[model samples]
Target: MGLACAVAWLAALTVYDVRQRRLPNALTLPGAVIVLITAALAGRGAAALLGAVALGALYLVMHLTAPSAMGAGDVKLAIGVGALTGAFGVDAWVLATVAAPLLTAAWGIVGFRARGGGATGRIAVPHGPSMCVATVAAVAVVVI
Candidate 1:
Protein backbone atom coordinates (compact mmCIF):
# COMPACT_ATOMS: atom_id res chain seq x y z
CA MET A 1 0.00 0.00 0.00
CA GLY A 2 2.75 2.43 0.95
CA LEU A 3 4.77 1.51 -2.10
CA ALA A 4 1.77 1.99 -4.33
CA CYS A 5 1.01 5.38 -2.87
CA ALA A 6 4.58 6.52 -3.22
CA VAL A 7 4.73 5.40 -6.84
CA ALA A 8 1.49 7.14 -7.73
CA TRP A 9 2.42 10.25 -5.81
CA LEU A 10 5.84 10.44 -7.47
CA ALA A 11 4.34 9.89 -10.90
CA ALA A 12 1.73 12.62 -10.49
CA LEU A 13 4.16 15.16 -9.11
CA THR A 14 6.85 14.36 -11.69
CA VAL A 15 4.45 14.83 -14.58
CA TYR A 16 3.19 18.09 -13.12
CA ASP A 17 6.70 19.39 -12.63
CA VAL A 18 7.83 18.47 -16.12
CA ARG A 19 4.84 19.99 -17.84
CA GLN A 20 4.07 22.96 -15.61
CA ARG A 21 7.48 23.65 -14.06
CA ARG A 22 5.65 23.89 -10.74
CA LEU A 23 4.22 21.58 -8.16
CA PRO A 24 0.70 22.45 -7.17
CA ASN A 25 -0.19 22.63 -3.49
CA ALA A 26 -3.06 20.38 -4.44
CA LEU A 27 -0.57 17.56 -4.88
CA THR A 28 2.39 18.49 -2.68
CA LEU A 29 0.55 19.56 0.48
CA PRO A 30 -1.69 16.53 0.62
CA GLY A 31 1.14 14.27 -0.41
CA ALA A 32 3.02 15.07 2.77
CA VAL A 33 -0.08 14.32 4.82
CA ILE A 34 -0.69 11.03 3.08
CA VAL A 35 2.94 9.97 3.50
CA LEU A 36 2.85 10.86 7.18
CA ILE A 37 -0.37 8.97 7.76
CA THR A 38 1.09 5.87 6.23
CA ALA A 39 4.35 6.32 8.07
CA ALA A 40 2.51 6.67 11.33
CA LEU A 41 0.59 3.49 10.63
CA ALA A 42 3.93 1.81 10.11
CA GLY A 43 5.22 3.16 13.44
CA ARG A 44 7.82 5.45 11.84
CA GLY A 45 6.17 8.81 12.24
CA ALA A 46 9.10 10.41 14.02
CA ALA A 47 11.61 9.42 11.40
CA ALA A 48 9.23 10.31 8.62
CA LEU A 49 8.60 13.74 10.09
CA LEU A 50 12.30 14.19 10.56
CA GLY A 51 12.88 13.49 6.87
CA ALA A 52 10.18 15.93 5.83
CA VAL A 53 11.51 18.66 8.08
CA ALA A 54 15.12 18.16 7.10
CA LEU A 55 14.55 18.13 3.36
CA GLY A 56 12.01 20.94 3.58
CA ALA A 57 14.45 23.04 5.53
CA LEU A 58 17.23 22.42 3.05
CA TYR A 59 15.05 23.48 0.12
CA LEU A 60 13.63 26.34 2.13
CA VAL A 61 17.13 27.72 2.66
CA MET A 62 17.94 27.25 -1.01
CA HIS A 63 14.78 29.04 -2.04
CA LEU A 64 15.37 31.81 0.44
CA THR A 65 18.96 32.45 -0.54
CA ALA A 66 18.38 32.24 -4.27
CA PRO A 67 14.82 32.65 -5.43
CA SER A 68 15.59 31.96 -9.07
CA ALA A 69 17.80 29.00 -8.25
CA MET A 70 15.07 27.16 -6.40
CA GLY A 71 11.36 27.70 -6.40
CA ALA A 72 8.78 27.58 -3.59
CA GLY A 73 7.17 24.59 -5.24
CA ASP A 74 10.39 22.62 -4.77
CA VAL A 75 10.38 23.39 -1.07
CA LYS A 76 6.82 22.23 -0.83
CA LEU A 77 7.62 19.07 -2.74
CA ALA A 78 10.46 18.32 -0.34
CA ILE A 79 7.94 17.65 2.41
CA GLY A 80 6.66 14.57 0.63
CA VAL A 81 10.16 13.62 -0.47
CA GLY A 82 11.41 13.63 3.09
CA ALA A 83 8.55 11.67 4.58
CA LEU A 84 8.59 8.91 2.00
CA THR A 85 12.31 8.28 2.09
CA GLY A 86 12.72 9.13 5.75
CA ALA A 87 10.41 6.32 6.77
CA PHE A 88 12.97 3.90 5.47
CA GLY A 89 15.78 5.15 7.79
CA VAL A 90 18.40 7.83 8.17
CA ASP A 91 20.34 6.30 5.32
CA ALA A 92 17.45 6.40 2.91
CA TRP A 93 16.43 9.87 3.98
CA VAL A 94 19.97 11.22 3.72
CA LEU A 95 20.50 9.62 0.35
CA ALA A 96 17.26 11.01 -1.02
CA THR A 97 17.94 14.44 0.39
CA VAL A 98 21.41 14.54 -1.09
CA ALA A 99 20.58 12.87 -4.37
CA ALA A 100 17.66 15.11 -5.31
CA PRO A 101 19.59 18.37 -5.48
CA LEU A 102 22.60 16.73 -7.08
CA LEU A 103 20.34 15.31 -9.73
CA THR A 104 18.73 18.69 -10.29
CA ALA A 105 22.06 20.44 -10.52
CA ALA A 106 23.29 17.94 -13.06
CA TRP A 107 20.20 18.36 -15.15
CA GLY A 108 20.41 22.11 -14.86
CA ILE A 109 23.96 22.09 -16.16
CA VAL A 110 23.03 19.90 -19.07
CA GLY A 111 20.00 21.93 -19.95
CA PHE A 112 21.94 25.14 -19.68
CA ARG A 113 24.67 23.89 -21.98
CA ALA A 114 22.36 22.29 -24.49
CA ARG A 115 19.81 25.06 -24.79
CA GLY A 116 21.85 28.10 -23.79
CA GLY A 117 20.10 29.57 -20.75
CA GLY A 118 23.14 31.62 -19.75
CA ALA A 119 21.46 34.78 -21.01
CA THR A 120 18.58 34.19 -18.64
CA GLY A 121 20.87 34.49 -15.57
CA ARG A 122 19.84 31.08 -14.25
CA ILE A 123 19.13 27.64 -15.58
CA ALA A 124 15.59 26.59 -14.81
CA VAL A 125 15.06 22.98 -13.95
CA PRO A 126 11.94 21.56 -12.38
CA HIS A 127 13.18 20.35 -8.99
CA GLY A 128 10.06 18.46 -8.08
CA PRO A 129 11.02 15.75 -10.55
CA SER A 130 14.43 15.37 -8.95
CA MET A 131 12.86 15.13 -5.52
CA CYS A 132 10.36 12.58 -6.70
CA VAL A 133 13.01 10.52 -8.46
CA ALA A 134 15.35 10.59 -5.50
CA THR A 135 12.63 9.52 -3.12
CA VAL A 136 11.65 6.59 -5.27
CA ALA A 137 15.27 5.51 -5.72
CA ALA A 138 15.93 5.74 -2.00
CA VAL A 139 12.80 3.81 -1.13
CA ALA A 140 13.75 1.17 -3.65
CA VAL A 141 17.14 0.88 -2.02
CA VAL A 142 15.52 0.22 1.32
CA VAL A 143 12.89 -2.13 0.01
CA ILE A 144 15.19 -4.30 -2.04
Candidate 2:
Protein backbone atom coordinates (compact mmCIF):
# COMPACT_ATOMS: atom_id res chain seq x y z
CA MET A 1 0.00 0.00 0.00
CA GLY A 2 2.79 2.41 0.84
CA LEU A 3 4.64 1.50 -2.28
CA ALA A 4 1.54 2.04 -4.40
CA CYS A 5 0.92 5.44 -2.90
CA ALA A 6 4.55 6.45 -3.41
CA VAL A 7 4.46 5.46 -7.06
CA ALA A 8 1.17 7.24 -7.66
CA TRP A 9 2.40 10.34 -5.91
CA LEU A 10 5.60 10.35 -7.96
CA ALA A 11 3.67 9.85 -11.19
CA ALA A 12 1.38 12.78 -10.50
CA LEU A 13 4.25 15.05 -9.52
CA THR A 14 6.28 14.04 -12.53
CA VAL A 15 3.42 14.89 -14.89
CA TYR A 16 2.79 18.23 -13.25
CA ASP A 17 6.46 19.19 -13.21
CA VAL A 18 6.97 18.16 -16.81
CA ARG A 19 4.00 20.17 -17.98
CA GLN A 20 4.20 23.23 -15.72
CA ARG A 21 7.83 23.21 -14.56
CA ARG A 22 6.46 23.56 -11.07
CA LEU A 23 5.21 21.32 -8.29
CA PRO A 24 2.27 23.10 -6.75
CA ASN A 25 1.73 23.15 -3.00
CA ALA A 26 -1.67 21.60 -3.50
CA LEU A 27 -0.03 18.30 -4.39
CA THR A 28 3.14 18.45 -2.31
CA LEU A 29 1.66 19.31 1.07
CA PRO A 30 -1.06 16.68 0.95
CA GLY A 31 1.35 14.22 -0.53
CA ALA A 32 3.71 14.71 2.39
CA VAL A 33 0.86 14.10 4.80
CA ILE A 34 -0.16 10.96 3.01
CA VAL A 35 3.36 9.64 2.86
CA LEU A 36 3.81 10.22 6.55
CA ILE A 37 0.52 8.58 7.43
CA THR A 38 1.30 5.62 5.28
CA ALA A 39 4.74 5.27 6.75
CA ALA A 40 3.36 5.42 10.25
CA LEU A 41 0.82 2.80 9.46
CA ALA A 42 3.55 0.65 8.02
CA GLY A 43 5.51 0.72 11.29
CA ARG A 44 8.29 2.94 10.07
CA GLY A 45 6.94 6.19 11.39
CA ALA A 46 9.99 7.17 13.39
CA ALA A 47 12.42 6.68 10.57
CA ALA A 48 10.09 8.36 8.12
CA LEU A 49 9.72 11.38 10.35
CA LEU A 50 13.45 11.61 10.83
CA GLY A 51 14.04 11.27 7.13
CA ALA A 52 11.54 14.01 6.34
CA VAL A 53 13.13 16.46 8.73
CA ALA A 54 16.70 15.67 7.80
CA LEU A 55 16.22 15.72 4.05
CA GLY A 56 13.86 18.69 4.16
CA ALA A 57 16.40 20.62 6.17
CA LEU A 58 19.14 19.68 3.75
CA TYR A 59 17.10 20.88 0.82
CA LEU A 60 16.08 24.01 2.67
CA VAL A 61 19.74 24.85 3.14
CA MET A 62 20.41 24.30 -0.53
CA HIS A 63 17.48 26.47 -1.47
CA LEU A 64 18.59 29.21 0.88
CA THR A 65 22.12 29.20 -0.48
CA ALA A 66 21.08 28.88 -4.14
CA PRO A 67 17.50 29.81 -4.81
CA SER A 68 17.98 29.66 -8.56
CA ALA A 69 19.31 26.09 -8.40
CA MET A 70 16.73 24.62 -6.01
CA GLY A 71 13.19 25.84 -5.85
CA ALA A 72 10.83 25.95 -2.86
CA GLY A 73 8.60 23.32 -4.41
CA ASP A 74 11.51 20.93 -4.68
CA VAL A 75 12.14 21.29 -0.98
CA LYS A 76 8.56 20.43 -0.15
CA LEU A 77 8.61 17.47 -2.49
CA ALA A 78 11.80 16.23 -0.85
CA ILE A 79 9.89 15.78 2.39
CA GLY A 80 7.66 13.21 0.82
CA VAL A 81 10.51 11.54 -1.01
CA GLY A 82 12.52 11.33 2.16
CA ALA A 83 9.62 9.99 4.13
CA LEU A 84 8.87 7.32 1.60
CA THR A 85 12.47 6.21 1.14
CA GLY A 86 13.25 6.55 4.80
CA ALA A 87 10.49 4.12 5.59
CA PHE A 88 12.63 1.53 3.88
CA GLY A 89 15.79 2.56 5.75
CA VAL A 90 18.60 5.10 6.00
CA ASP A 91 20.36 3.43 3.10
CA ALA A 92 17.37 4.02 0.84
CA TRP A 93 17.14 7.67 1.79
CA VAL A 94 20.84 8.14 1.18
CA LEU A 95 20.63 6.39 -2.17
CA ALA A 96 17.76 8.56 -3.33
CA THR A 97 19.49 11.73 -2.19
CA VAL A 98 22.69 10.81 -3.97
CA ALA A 99 20.90 9.67 -7.10
CA ALA A 100 18.62 12.69 -7.56
CA PRO A 101 21.33 15.33 -8.04
CA LEU A 102 23.47 13.11 -10.21
CA LEU A 103 20.51 12.26 -12.42
CA THR A 104 19.44 15.89 -12.57
CA ALA A 105 22.94 17.06 -13.48
CA ALA A 106 23.28 14.44 -16.16
CA TRP A 107 19.94 15.34 -17.66
CA GLY A 108 20.76 19.04 -17.45
CA ILE A 109 24.00 18.47 -19.30
CA VAL A 110 22.18 16.62 -22.05
CA GLY A 111 19.61 19.36 -22.24
CA PHE A 112 22.28 22.05 -22.32
CA ARG A 113 24.20 20.36 -25.09
CA ALA A 114 21.00 19.85 -27.00
CA ARG A 115 20.15 23.56 -26.79
CA GLY A 116 23.15 24.57 -29.00
CA GLY A 117 25.59 25.39 -26.18
CA GLY A 118 25.12 29.15 -26.19
CA ALA A 119 23.19 30.28 -23.17
CA THR A 120 24.13 32.36 -20.19
CA GLY A 121 21.01 31.99 -18.10
CA ARG A 122 19.81 28.97 -16.13
CA ILE A 123 18.28 26.14 -18.09
CA ALA A 124 14.86 25.38 -16.64
CA VAL A 125 15.33 21.66 -16.31
CA PRO A 126 12.73 20.20 -14.02
CA HIS A 127 14.17 18.50 -10.92
CA GLY A 128 10.96 16.74 -9.97
CA PRO A 129 11.35 14.05 -12.63
CA SER A 130 14.86 13.33 -11.54
CA MET A 131 13.71 13.14 -7.94
CA CYS A 132 10.92 10.75 -8.83
CA VAL A 133 13.23 8.55 -10.86
CA ALA A 134 15.77 8.41 -8.07
CA THR A 135 13.12 7.61 -5.49
CA VAL A 136 11.76 4.78 -7.59
CA ALA A 137 15.23 3.43 -8.17
CA ALA A 138 15.98 3.56 -4.48
CA VAL A 139 12.76 1.76 -3.66
CA ALA A 140 13.59 -0.89 -6.22
CA VAL A 141 16.97 -1.39 -4.65
CA VAL A 142 15.44 -1.86 -1.26
CA VAL A 143 12.62 -4.11 -2.43
CA ILE A 144 14.72 -6.29 -4.69
Off by over 4 Å in 1: 116-122
Per-candidate Cα lDDT values, in order, are: 0.88, 0.91
Distance (Å) between predicted and true CA of 14, model 2?
0.6
lDDT of 2 by residue, 28-58 (tens): 9899889899889889999999999989999
Please count the clashing residue pairs in each candidate, in the order shown: 0, 0
Native-referenced Cα lDDT, model 2: 0.91
Clashes of 2: 0
Q: List pairs with backbone clashes in candidate 1.
A: none
Q: After superposition, how far is residue 47 of candidate 2 from its true place, in Å?
A: 0.4
TM-scores for all predictions: 0.91, 0.95
Question: What are the clashing pairs of model 2?
Answer: none
